[model samples]
Target chain A: MLRKLTVLAAAVGLAFVATSALAASTKEEPVAPSAPWSFDGPFGTYDQAQLQRGYKVYREVCSSCHSMNLLAFRNLGDKGGPFWDPKYKSSVENGYVKAIAKDYQIADIDRDTGDAIKRPGTPADHFVAPFANEAAARASNGGALPPDMSLLARAREGGPDYIYSIVTGYHPAPAGLTVPAGKFYNPYMQGDLSSFWKGDPNKVPVGGFIAMPPPLADGKVSFDDKSPSDLKAEARDVSAFLMWAADPKMEERKQTGLAVMIFLLVFSGILYASYRTLWRNIDHH
Target chain B: MTAHTTYEPKTAIERWLDTRLPIVRLGAEVLEFPTPKNLNYWWTFGGILSFCLATQIVTGIVLAMHYQAGGASAFLSVEQGIMRDVNYGWLIRGIHANGASMFFIAVYIHMFRGMYYGSYKAPRELLWLLGCVIYLLMMATAFMGYVLPWGQMSFWGAKVITNLLGAFPIIGKPITTLLWGGFAVDDPTLNRFFSLHYLLPFLIAAVVALHIWALHVPGNNNPTGVEVKSKADTVPFHPYYTVKDGFAIGVFLILFAVFIFYEPDALGHADNFIAANPLVTPAHIVPEWYFLPFYAILRAIPDKLSGVIAMFGAIAMLFALPWLNTSKVKSMRYRPTSKVYFLVFVVVCLILGWCGAQLPDDAVIPALGKTGINLIDSDLNSYVWLSRIATAYYFAYFLLITPILGLRETPLPVPDSISKPVLAGEAAKKD
Candidate 1:
């Protein structure tokens, strides 16, 4: 069996080398290394404090342009989420979700008057869009549409790492390279043709350019608990928060995984015992 | 089938039922069927596969309850409604998505076990063929399921694969059009895919019944590749194999749950979270991992028509397997050279899968650095050529190696009975 495994490994290794040799010549988008995530491994859980800080970063910075349209204000109070309130049940009457919702104004029509009206947000309302419509968003952002932040972490290749890299990867174009107007050099963003800002032979990042400028800066948003207020720290926090937003059921899932695995293992042990006893004396042909 | 005590209806109700339909008798026969005592853990995969099928069906029916199949709403429905709003919807959707992968994983193990043990040979030919039919349906069901998500990969993968049918001579164009339900993959295509996806699993279930019936006709072939000659060589399926299969399923479910809960999206492509946009295509549009081996075979050939033929032919080749290998020995374990070849075949298939996942234009491995010696074009990478070689080996393993190895290589000494090794304590050594 060992010999068989060795032979199989050698065959696969040879094939991998032969094929990868060819794949080396073609230039593809560079995949950024994933930063260590709090919820990465089986036993991992989100640091609630960090998630809250990250949510702050998103609210103050990212929400200006990007929309988290799929998220309800009520989602903030769910367990495993950043703003979960233990005291709050399903109803959000006086909970933190209600408080958070009050920070933004939501647009709705007045049922009695039959006219458009602006009102304070509640837990039921989705995150308010910065712009009224797609056309307005495009007009404001130099024709590039800002993607929704709700599933941004999952939608991108490297998840949280990709978001962090893009947010912090901005650099000046190298010598002999021209910066196209309205585009900034960021190696990680998947933008249009001009976004491929590999202008500087010396400084061009793997991916070309990005339309969204550096959205994070040092000390941009002060943390209540006084975690690091640097650009990298902010990027990491927001990315983590986005990841939680993308899959809020992660904590429940990991807990369920632990219980299920333990149950199965015990069940298997019982079955094995029964198997041994059943076959103990049946040894003839 | 191995001889067993015929079912005797003890109770009045059982007797009446037995006289009317014999359903109870059939159930009793299945439960008490004589299975070879020497059958190993590999045999447990059939039960595991059945559990996966039932899981997929149950979870799929629930997912469909909330799943919106229309083009405009399908993507949002999955990402928002199914994943977010519905109670425990995330868990159900996660299980369904990952369950497809689990199902394929079990099926592959089952098929390979059959191959290694020569379970496809002789009287089990129809059984093996029925398995192939089930596999074909599974691929179709999985493909259609992937498309219903309406993501970038979903749209592009559906388009790329559906267009492959156009490579056919005269009937290809119409078939492709009919499949799409229009000039392009639109709302109509999504609806039809949803309908067929719901329908094919039941067909697979029906065929699985036939597969089992065929297996019962000849009973099971033991790992020793020898037929059972007496009652001592066999055991009742109820208490022994049942407990064993149940334990194996527990193990399988544990692994499945790890993926379902901890890393549900790990097996999935991240790009799938993005809604389907016909205007934008991903840099590399690849099928799900299970389809990669066949996908590699498809791309191994450059011509569209030939690639299409080769892809389908790869699956069709399995149906001819019982006749292709002329070996009299039933198990690869007894055929030393054939065992080595079998290992090589498994490796080649894995490499083919890895190749399929890679971008065709990218280099798989870098050219030997600064050798100043170039084999072909300095610009051309080795990935395509390696894929071709692996693809050739995949076919040759079935077409040439099996028959030739049977005639050429000497096999190990054969045990006359399944109980011989166990009685002599050699079975423990094998384990």
Candidate 2:
């Protein structure tokens, strides 16, 4: 029975690995090259200082074109967030988050007059979009609508890794490859570019034309913590921030999982004991 | 023969209730039911499936409280209102989402176990049919539930699956329009799907009642496929199975919790995180993993109508299984030749599922590309061809092998009773 149980456990582990391999299979080239993600494993936790820097990049650069509609201002100071502090019992009361919210004007209706007006953003308010709707967003950015960044990390194949790859994958198009106007070539973007290549059809370039130009440059945004402001650092930082935005409760989830796992293990062990004991007297075959 | 009741009135209120309703007696009779003594770990799936259904229902109800059925608000309600604002809504939604997968896993195992042991044979045909109905309902529920999130996959999956009806002649267009509540998949489709998604589980629960009732009559089919000859061949459901099933459930929950907490998105598609936009279609559209085998079947043929019929026929095989089988041998353990074919059938299903996930035009073996004559619609060396081959075997296993093999094959000697093998010092653990 124990041998069978061990075999079952191994089969389960193998199956999990196999399914993950199947899911991770993508035609995209340069394959979101693996990076050292702080939150890669079950026990992994987000680096708070890195998240804060990531938030800085997002606010200074990404915020202009992209929306974080799912995120509230107070989320920045919530547990596991960029501006989180132990001293703040609630994120709404966090002075740093409050100050940041105050910098934006939020759309509202005046109670007395019932008229639309812009008001100072509150901690409870969702992030303000750069445009009113998808049409306006597309109109502003050539024809490509900059996707909302709230769930950007999760919405891509490799999560933070994919984000980091796309942000930093911009390069000079190989000779014989037609680079269209207002479109930048990115080696990490998933698409077929065979038709756009004048080179050998079989040996066509491994990337696609992206609408957004290279948004990051070396020393674009100076870090408050004096971290390097190279294009790579900025990309990595923002990628991590987007991941946090996508899964803000990861820390709590992992913690709860650990406890639940331990409890179920113990409970199963007890049940096994009782099962063996109760069935002890019965067995002829 | 009716199962004997063990209930005795303890108090005056119990006496009154026993005579008026007998609900207590019914409950006691179930607990005191004589299950076969030699039933193995494979039998534990019944309990695990019940747990899966209850988990889905409880978590689903919680999710509905926070969910909006409107097309516009549906994505927002799921991504923001539930996942963000509501307390532990992430956990609840994760359980509900992942629970569907878990339910299918348990059910597939249960069904296969029945097939392997021939629990679906003879008097248990109605029981198997009832289980089949439950499975059909489950597929419908899971499909509609996926659409409730209103993600890219949700909208597109609904559009693709519902459009299969449009492949039928004449009435197809009208049925699809009626189903969608409009000409296209939109807000009304989401609303009705929500209503149906909420409605189907209780219907499943009602059928489950009949399934259990049907099972209690025939009792359990043991691993040896031997009927009980005496009291020694059976055991009460209490304590022995209760503890055993409890242990299995606890282990199953550990697996469930691992997905809910550590890797909730592992079983889900990344595109689902993006809100559904009818204006833009995604690069790849795939249904949940459980539906992949059927999806492959649907895509096996080039013609849309034929493909749709083939897909539904795959499910219809299960319903017609008992009648198709001609074998008197109840267990594969006694029918060695038949067992080999059954294993191959399982492998074929897995292959079909893998093919379904790949692009139909993609080569199964890249280096061996273009092994046969190229078709106008699909290459012969591609996943489409692979699926066609597997689908052929899938239908053949039911329509040809089961009946013919049952007639020709020589089975090993069978035990006279459930306890006979043990008395003969044979463990009866070959399965």
Q: List the residue pairs that clash in candidate 2.
A: A285-B422
Q: Where does candidate 1 stray beyond 4 Å?
A: A1-35, A190-205, B1-3, B367-381, B421-431
Q: In model 1 chain B, where is the ten-residue run with the lowest total lDDT?
A: B370-379
TM-score of each: 0.91, 0.97
TM-score of 2: 0.97
Question: Per-residue lDDT tens digits of candidate 2, residues B10-89?
Answer: 99999999889988888888888888888877788899998899999999998989999998899999999898889999
Query: Chain A TM-scores, one per candidate?
Result: 0.82, 0.93
**lDDT by residue for model 1 over A1-285, one digit each (tens)?**
364345335433433343343343224455555567888788889989989999999999999999998899888888878878677667355378888898888888999998999899998989888998878998999988898899999887667887888887787765544567997876665643443444644444456667888899999999999899998889889999999999888898889889888888899778878877887876522
Backbone clash tally for model 2?
Answer: 1
The candidates' DockQ values read 0.40, 0.58
- For each candidate in the order shown, give its overall lDDT on alpha carbons: 0.82, 0.88
What lDDT does candidate 1 reach at residue A222? 99
Tens digits of per-residue lDDT for model 1, B1-431? 43465789999999899789988888888999988987777788888888899999999999999999999999989998999889889899989998998888778878888999999999789999999999999999999999999998899999999999999999999998999999999999999999999999999999999988998988998788888778878898888889878877876776777678876776677778988988878867878888888888898788889999999999988999999989988998789889989989988987887778776544555554233443453324555666788999999999999989888888887787887762455566642
Give residue B394's lDDT in candidate 1 (0 to 100).
91
Q: Candidate 2 on A59-153: residue-level lDDT in tens?
A: 99999999999999999999999999999899999999999999999989999999999999989998999899988999999999999999999
Query: Top model by DockQ, which number?
Result: 2
Off by over 4 Å in 2: A6-28, A32-34, B422-431
